[model samples]
Target: MDLSGGTLEIVVSAVVISISVPGNILLIYCTRRCIDEQLRTSFTLIFSLAWTNLIYNLVVNILKIVYASNVELDSAVCKVLMFTAVFTTSLAIWFTLYIALLFCSKLCRVVHPPVEAACKNYQKFHMVLVFTLWVAGVAVCCPVLLYTRRIEKLNTENETYQQFSSLIYTECKTEYRNDLIEILYGKIFLGAINLLPLLIMLLTGFRIVYLLWEHRKATYGGIWIGGDASELEVVRACKIILLLIFVITSFCVSYFSLVYCLKNFKSCYFAPPVLTVLSSGYSSVSPYLLMLINYKVIVRMRCFCCKDEKKLVTVSAIAPVSPYA
Candidate 1:
């Protein structure tokens, strides 16, 4: 079915707010509750991304909803809303890149962490890094605030609205200025958000793949039984990171496609199937990926729902203890 822009906006808003808000809240709680410090650090990064997405989605979609409802805003509100959305979207891109890096480090097994003496230093570095990225996002989106302008309407009712659509100019600046700045922004996004991270993610993944291959070929008898499983686990994690990159980058590319398409071909705004699916697919699909990859979250979800059921199974079944548990 062809959904109107207003309908689409509301649907997207509902889905993102419902998913990201609660999902990220739970993620933050889980990260804080993790007993393993290293595991907690990884979960913390994921939680940070989740938090960013939640806030970004809520703010952006609210503005979108208001605009879709034909609620014109003053300059100050426009500036703040636009800047917040752009800044947080930038934050989301870099946060995903950071996650890809973390996955790579794990795969390399070169993540030989520092001694206990340097734990504070290590955490401090992470804090500084995340702060730097947030600051950079703010800086990148600063120009957005300048685009703020009061949008006025002559006739905003029924037949008058349809006739006056051409007269309405809510955009802050001339098309030329917006285009030039957005072009620069586009290049930066293509490089920083898509190209750079994709390269790093791919490079690290294949390096780990070669390393795993070398380790597996060493023809030790008993090593295959134990070492093989560990290697396989690492490979599995590598696959997850690779899949993560695909899902993450696919969203970036899809939006870029929409931007370019909208720029060159305005007629597509009538809710082309490709455009509609691409637009909706990002928020619709991302939560599934995040939940799937977070092994702990998966465990938590089951335990969250069926804590009593688990006990019943343990008690009812015959207790057969091997040397292991």
Candidate 2:
């Protein structure tokens, strides 16, 4: 059956909320329960990411539902939705990049000694960096508050313009003050904020692969690296980070590509569902991937599945070491 755009949007929003809400909440609970004293920085980043995703799902998707329901909302609500969307998206990207960087630092300390000195104090500044990223996201997204509003139809005789206006009237859309401001904020600034991190993640992923290959080669030789257990944990963490990077990159690339196609080729009627999936797909899926970083969570999940209280107790006493820890 063919669905209208509004019906599809609501359906997509409902699906995203269903997955993202519980997934992010469980991730937050598990991360908090297993926060490592020595690796507080890493735990904090994960916690922030879960919280951001949860907030994004709640604010953006719910508002999207309201909009799709043909309910009239104030311009303030539109502004809030637009602002939250951009702010949360920026925060998620930065948080994921920070986690990847943390893993990269740990791996580099072992695999590449030349960069060890620079990365030594990285953990100490994580809190400062987190604060800065949040503040910067706010500053960068403030323009949304100014430029975004509910689109209303103009008194025009043009059929095409009327059709376009009606299509977007129920949506929160941005109308910048001028061409320059639009180009600057819409194209250049926002593009850099998202694109730069992906570039860094790509470089970090390459470095991680190189380090893993080197470590494996060294192990096959007569060389014995220190702290096999700890190194193994770091290696595991690197693998998770690589996977996380891959997920984020895939979602981002697909989302941007669809956005570009829709902007340039207005007849792309299939964009809505695909765009919705790309937009919220990562938030729904990334938390479960992150749960793999904490072994205690896995063991607890296994115990729960087996319905064995004694196994739970035993798992609790085992003092499982998280890679982040």
Clashes of each: 0, 0
Give the per-residue Cα lDDT of candidate 2 at 56.
91
- lDDT tens digits by residue: candidate 2, 102-146: 888778766655633453445557888888888898999999899
lDDT of 2: 0.76
Per-prediction TM-score to the true structure, in the order listed: 0.70, 0.86
**Residue 95 of model 1, lDDT score:** 75
lDDT tens readout by residue for model 1, 171-288: 3322215576667664565346545755665666576567556445543444433333333444455566666667656766776666554563322333332343443344445445
Model 1 earns a TM-score of 0.70
TM-score, candidate 2, is: 0.86
Q: Please give the CA lDDT of all the candidate structures.
A: 0.54, 0.76
Q: What's the C-alpha lDDT at position 145 in model 1?
A: 78
